[model samples]
Target: MDRVFSFQASGVCINTQHHLDALCVYFSDRDQLDSLEFYSDLEASLKSAVLLPDCVVMIASRKFCEDIKEYWSNDVLKASFVTRGERSGKPFIKYYYLYCWETSGLVEVFSHCADADVKPCFNLSICDLVQQGLYHLVKENNVVQIAPVGHLFKHPSGTRNNIFIQARELAKTEPELCFVGRSISLAFGFERFAKLSVVYIDSMGIYHFVQEALSFCKVDARIHSFHSYDEMRKLTPPPIEHLIVISASTSGGMARDLRNDQGFSDSRILTLIDKSDSDRSGKVLIALESVDKNIFDFEADNFETEIELVGEHFSSKAKPPRAVTLGRPHTPPKLLKFLKEFGRDGLNSLNEIIDGQPKVLSLVTEKVSRNKVFLKWLEEEVSWNITVAIDTVICTDDLGSIEIANTVADLISTHKVGSARPTVCVYRNVDWSSVSNATGVLVVTAVARDGGLLREISRDLRENLNSEINCPRHYLTAVGLPQSKETWSRLKQFLERNASERLYGFSEWLVLPIGSDRQSNHWSDLAALAKTSQVVEVESSVVSKSVVDASLDLVSDAIRKGFNGFLPKTDGSDLALSSGFIYFGDVFKDDLESALHATSYLAIASALQKARDIDDVANQLRSTGYESVILSPECFLRFNDNILHACILRGCRKGELDYSSSPHHSKLMGEFLLKVFSRHQLPYGAAAVEFAAALATQRLKLKKNDQERLVGKVVNSLKDEPSALLGLLLMVDLPRVSMLSIK
Candidate 1:
């Protein structure tokens, strides 16, 4: 009775183009019966090669051993080796041999290996396989020194069997520090890796092990040690990303408790063994049974999207991030109007203020008009009161919310709304002790969807965590969705009934009306506007009739197809309040209409600003018969100086808006756009422009006989500017173009 099993080999360290070409040649020569395979990137190629069955892996670099170790599961008979050439003193490469057998052709594979020139390690206790032929490194009569590395491999019992057999040179520096903790560096973006919290549970030397691993990877992050679940929870915030729990001799109940009650996502928690005594025991089975489930079966995206590199040695430096546009991409009609009234020099001065230059609006625009427009809009839309005292401002840890909160804080300071500038803190990361004595709290979020997180914040602030807060002026600022409004109302009622009779404040200027099916007519109405709108007056430039018509048509088509840039959640909507950005889905259609209108411009610019690539929007538009959107005077000047000052302030503070590096800013841009689009009424500035236009149209119709005289009088009043004169003619001619030229 002999054992027979199907065999396969997977390899890493094949990171270069040369290695790929060599591996392809080697596999082809062996008659593995495969043509050239194509992959999108090197990471994709490496992943496919690692998963392929009946494959021969030629791993060349020890740097990639950490990646290969991730594939080591319970069913696989995995062996790690430290091998050196005959003339070399120290081991040059670390090899991991992982193979699982099915009762099909194990005998034939072993026979092939025996007849072959270089044998791979089949049983670590017996022999070591030299992976030298594929890349042609071996010469005549070269004997390689191969030693079994045992401590790295963990058994089910979590005990180290070869405690006395010490390979001191390799043990201290190579196996112990190179495998487990080094994975995180290549697994995620360097920015995330830098900030991640690494907590290891009840493992001796694991702290130093992880530190050394990170040092080897050329990165650093906060690392904490914990013994029990209670001890881990005392870390202020339990690990949201990485929790390393060491498996001891006996399978502990911690894994079960973490999965069931500790609110830890499976992908965030990783279990490791510090020492394994025997390699032949039921390691994988015991792990599966003891951990209650196979811990390795976590979310695939945790490994896929987060991995910045497959091999750290060959990875290139990330490109510099592009500038983020805080406002709409297209020029607004108001900016054109401003330029017509005041020249580019005046416009430049206004921009200087938005650019965070220490300039006053006294020279830019009339204080009376600017204050009247912006202050009225702010009071109506944001519910700002000069009299109400706000003790602290607690905002969701999102870029948009933070920006809005900071702006609101500035306004409070200007008006002296409180005794001092209220302390602004992010809710999730806020220190409870810092705000324990505060009596008033204002929760500001960009958008409130179902109010789940809001409820949590409310509970913690009002009842659970800080019950002594007694201020009646607690308020919330958000763009309330259909269900969120109801949830907030219920919460308010519950708080009022259970605690005090004081009225709570919630300001949502643009609460969208919910339909029978929980869908809002807001987007639908915008779609209708896109369909009927005949003219696209952008800047003071004359846009051709066909371009405007085609732009509108494409926008209508895209709306019918659903906002293609956004992916719907389980609720059948694109916006996810948790991430504060709409998930990037498909990009089949380009939003051309955004180029001509402020509202659409704001939406598309926000969408693209949050996009993974800034040029994606521009490229898509160009392919679809529209030019790439660019910032113009109207983008900021369309609104008053005050409005632009608040939104674009951070653009100056942080140097420039780089959404790629700061994903939080991208999320914030999405949130800001969500607030803009979700509004029931147009922004105050746009609404006023439309109102004035309608009034002028009505006056012209009334004085039919005196129309020529009235027009001449208007022309005489603005005789200095010819651009404004020509814009007036095109503005009135738009209706005629849609009727005659469109047909």
Candidate 2:
């Protein structure tokens, strides 16, 4: 009854290196040998061969020999085999079996058999033997089958015992594996060593399984259990970091839901199923196969292998992120400075202004011509380069006076030799316009001594030319008149007596006298006349091209300065109205062209002088209905002083003042009007009374009765004047008139 297993050589001697004693036994008809007897013989031979008591024995089995279980020892193992059975005409029945045994002596036996030269009687290799042993152990209920950490494992309810314990033991090396089952209750033994979080998505209503898992998984890991996906979705669960254990019955829906709804694309998932659900086409198998790797029938002992495979696979597939840059590396200092001064918007404006020609050229030209200081300052302090082309420079010869008819006829004959550029024909004391053939000529006539020159020039340009003139004709004038002491004394006396006399009419006849005292008296009289006259002109009586050129230089300088000031502040299209002087001359017609240019400096000087005596000027204007007129320095040079003065006075009386379309000029006129009204005394008339009353009401925000009383007082004050009766009639209301007995 004692069984023995024998290892014998089959006469196939193979030479091999060896360090231990080797024994081989020949076997004939090995299938007929008794299993227990063979095992006993093998053990005895192993002992005789000086092998350790730990020697192992292997048996090849052709069937599932249940009777051999009684004789099986720890030192005995079974190699796998296949047997076929034929029953009449029915299909053959095939059976496969494998088994293994392990003890303290197993390693010793393996070590002693390391270098045997004889071939073994069995046909199984070492790999075959190990696989067969593992297969047999998995088939038997002695060792529980465990799945890989991230895979589904199924077993019968009876065979679920010791599964968690084996998994915990495996977790010692590969900590990711933790087990939960109803039959086996094992606390998370890894709790003291490491912490983890387990999310059990229990769609199958496996509440008992969840409770058991939570209880057994006593590690620092937190176990969250939800019966349905909707319940789980209510709370924002942390990312599934450690593992997600789902029942195989619901694994497909759970996986799909987790991916589609919860955005769980990368969570490690484990599934649990029953042994009866082993159909490959089952939901559990399909779900497991759909994932990155299918981990089925995973043993706790292979936990490290499973984790390593998953770690390598995921690590290989991981992706990481990218980077960026900005702006220019370097900027020039000059460019930075420009940006700081003008800014990007301002620079664009400046570019536009430069592209458009400016409008204030003529006014600037006139202002520069009269002032010697401005002329000098322009030449030296303010650097300006200019080019001048003079077609003619007519001077007063020793002949005393030039005849208008002959001079024009001779100039016309000479100009017959036509030139490419336009001719600027200059003349003095002559009616140049009477010459009918003066086509393509820009005539600049000096009208200071010619009484009819201005009238004739106007007539010719307006009527005689027939629009044949290619360029505009202008009248040039000197800035101021010279005066002798005796003449200044006489003029001063005349002005003192007749304050409203047209002063510019006689200004040309006076000369600054030879003596220093006479010169002082001459200037004094001129200043006196300037303060008294409604309109006055001061001129140099020195008309020449040099003066014109100097005037132009100052004008250019003013324009440059104005542009420099405005460019940084404005967008090119619109500039400040106050700065209109910079482009004032560009808008002029030929009528005032020369006058405006010639008198610009003098007008500015006179304006400055009036500014200095602004209080006195304002008082005088307010007392009388008088406007302080500062004519251009050359105003008398081009037009008869008396006629010009009369025209201006008439314009003012009619409430007509021309600003030549210049805002700066318009502003100046407004300031003059304000000064004139600053302290105006009401005249004795209904209009004056009403004006006073309205002004008071407006200033004080007065009511009806208060305003009427004020008006009555004003009217009473003017009762002696002829217009006061009209004032009273206009002032009284019907009720008040009845009380006053006015008919």
Candidate 3:
């Protein structure tokens, strides 16, 4: 058996020679340094090399597998390369690309040797390397600037510093925090405090940065944060005389509240601004000298300059006061295009295989990693496009689609595109007056089958905007679409309107078009349809079976009383509770929505009455032509109720993650959810609050702090209602309520 070791050394490499020199110093203490050899020509090295087996081979510049058009052979032992770091887009170099080579000996060795026996050489993360590189850059570069929107700290030469400028922008609109926390550590008499907590409101964008900044300042105090005033009121400790409240910007609402509620004096609180204004009358103000920008003139890049010129050109033409201005349709990146195709092909491939999620995900991750494209598109691209003004609107009705739309809107607001914030609302409920003067409109959907709903949306949108002289840029975006070309054609025709211009409309899909018509209805939509569609009288025996379960009696009773006591549906749809416990019978012929809803309810009712397992219930739903959107992690998050969430999780355990023509199969969603939540991903505002509730009640073994971090403000709003959680768990096919933790 061969013992291979892997280590990562990430830092900026000026050129090829610089990278080699860095590698030599990085591997100075390793035994492998004695036999390590570098090769630029991969083909020559593979064919001509016949040296010692102990040698660690390296190939540079091009990706090894791509250059050779094949993966490594069985004889190869180990491979290393200098590649880009995960986060930093600068001239980064990562050491040891491949820890172990594909070899016949290793395959056999793996059968006998467990993973626990083979210890890794190093455990340094890419983030650690990025920080190291940033530290080096701060020392080397005399002139640096943080991009206004992206919050990237970088050299004037455009080389990235790999440090995020979190507090400078997210907290305020005035002069951004130019100096790093370390620079400000000695300023504003911050070092005078022997022990003081740095306090601020917690947000997904600014919380981590606050801690990082405090640590960078070499402060020794505990950091305190709250999501809102309510959280602050309930959870805040009694008044601490030495506490020093801090704000990155001049905004002092949190500071003011802390003063009034916790009795912190105005002199104790500090705001990093040049001067305190009337709005921040009571707080202390601190300022640092502006850095010298003479060495690096702050000028907009060509791309930004071009966008501005285009906007000016468009504005030059005569237009109506409320006319929608057309912003240029930015071309999608090639990497994103490749991902779409890869996703489409992968989806098609999954349809032909069973239990292939692990293999499929492994393949996708490997392929993506090979190209060194770390998948954080929303954080990177979408955030970069946010505008400060209200220039766009994302319209969607599907709860899953609502999440995506909300993500886009939040990113725009978090990172001003060009100082424009986008709005997200249901197409039916969209306030025309609010969005009428907007620059662009986007119609989004989770999935589109035959394109009927899309066409309906397009027609409605066109009608709404008919009063305007010029149409703004509009796009039809979807997570998934039908595999059929005919379906796509119909959609294009509706948007294009018969051999004319595109009418300021375009279509962009997150995944490749490879969904089936059977999977058209969204799961949330199905649930809504079941809850509101006309109810028919069922036999008393059927009702008796459901009533005997005892767990669902309260829910049934609540439904009978029009959900008076229970919380209103999160989607803002009214529930017309029927007089009796209605369950659909056979011979139900209706639209796809009604059909799927009926089948889903019937399946659950049958499972409950017959005391069958979830699998049996799932099978019944699938056999009855019940199909809905394959809940992605983004979609699975739509299920606020523990019952539906458990159903989704049960589907995940069955290796069903991809879009299915039938119900109860989607392992990908589970994996995605675990990955997303593990990273503490959030959509922002009310949407994030809803998602947090779903995550909190799902019994997923998440830590208390993690749950609080996911949604600090919303958790307080959820009263200590153990009875509600207990009732929800009991009414469905889930483990006993005792096993679940009450948030």
Among these predictions, the greatest TM-score belongs to 1
Ranking by TM-score: 1, 3, 2
TM-score of every prediction relative to native: 0.22, 0.16, 0.21
Q: In model 2, what is the error at residue 361, expressed in angstroms?
A: 99
Question: Which parts of model 3 are misplaced by more than 4 Å?
Answer: 1-180, 183-186, 194-210, 230-241, 246-263, 272-518, 522-743
Give the per-residue lDDT of model 1 (tens digit) for 1-743.
11111112223322321111111111111111111121112223333432322223322123222333343331222222111111154322222233221111011112112112333433321101112221111111111111112111122223112111111121132322332233323333245445555655444434654564456445555666664446655443353555443423223344444555556654444443212223322121112222222322222222111212111011112322223233333222232222222222222221123223321111232221133333345454444442356767888766656766676676666666435777898888888887777766677765444455677787777643456556644545444333323454675564344356546666542232111112222233334444544346422123444544444444344344432222121122322111111111111124321121222222232233333122444321111111112222223333332223222321111213223233444344333322332231333222221211221222112122232333333323323333212223223325442232210
Model 2, residue 319: distance off in Å is 52
**Model 1: number of backbone collisions:** 10
Candidate 3 structure, TM-score to reference: 0.21
lDDT of 2: 0.28
What local distance difference test score does each model get?
0.33, 0.28, 0.33
Please write out the lDDT profile of model 2 over residues 468-565, one tens digit for every residue. 43323322222112122244345334322322332211212111121111212212222232232222221111223243233223323322433322
State which candidate, 1 or 3, has the greater TM-score: 1
Q: 1-743, model 3: which lDDT tens digit per residue?
A: 11111122343322331322122111111122112232322323323323211112231112222322233321242233211112243222222332211111001111111122333322223223322322332323422223322222222223232222223342221111212232233333444443455454333344443444455445656666554446656644445424443433323555666678776566665543321234563443332122222422243443321101110011111110110111111111222343333322222221122233211111122233122232255446443432234356655564546665666676666666356456677877878777666666666554454567677876776666545545554554543333334466667666657233535455554433322323222222222322421232212211232322332333233233321111223232321222111122222223222322222222222222122111333222121111121223443444333223333332231112222221222233334433333332222121221222233234232333333232322222322322222123232212222132334
Clashes of each: 10, 39, 17
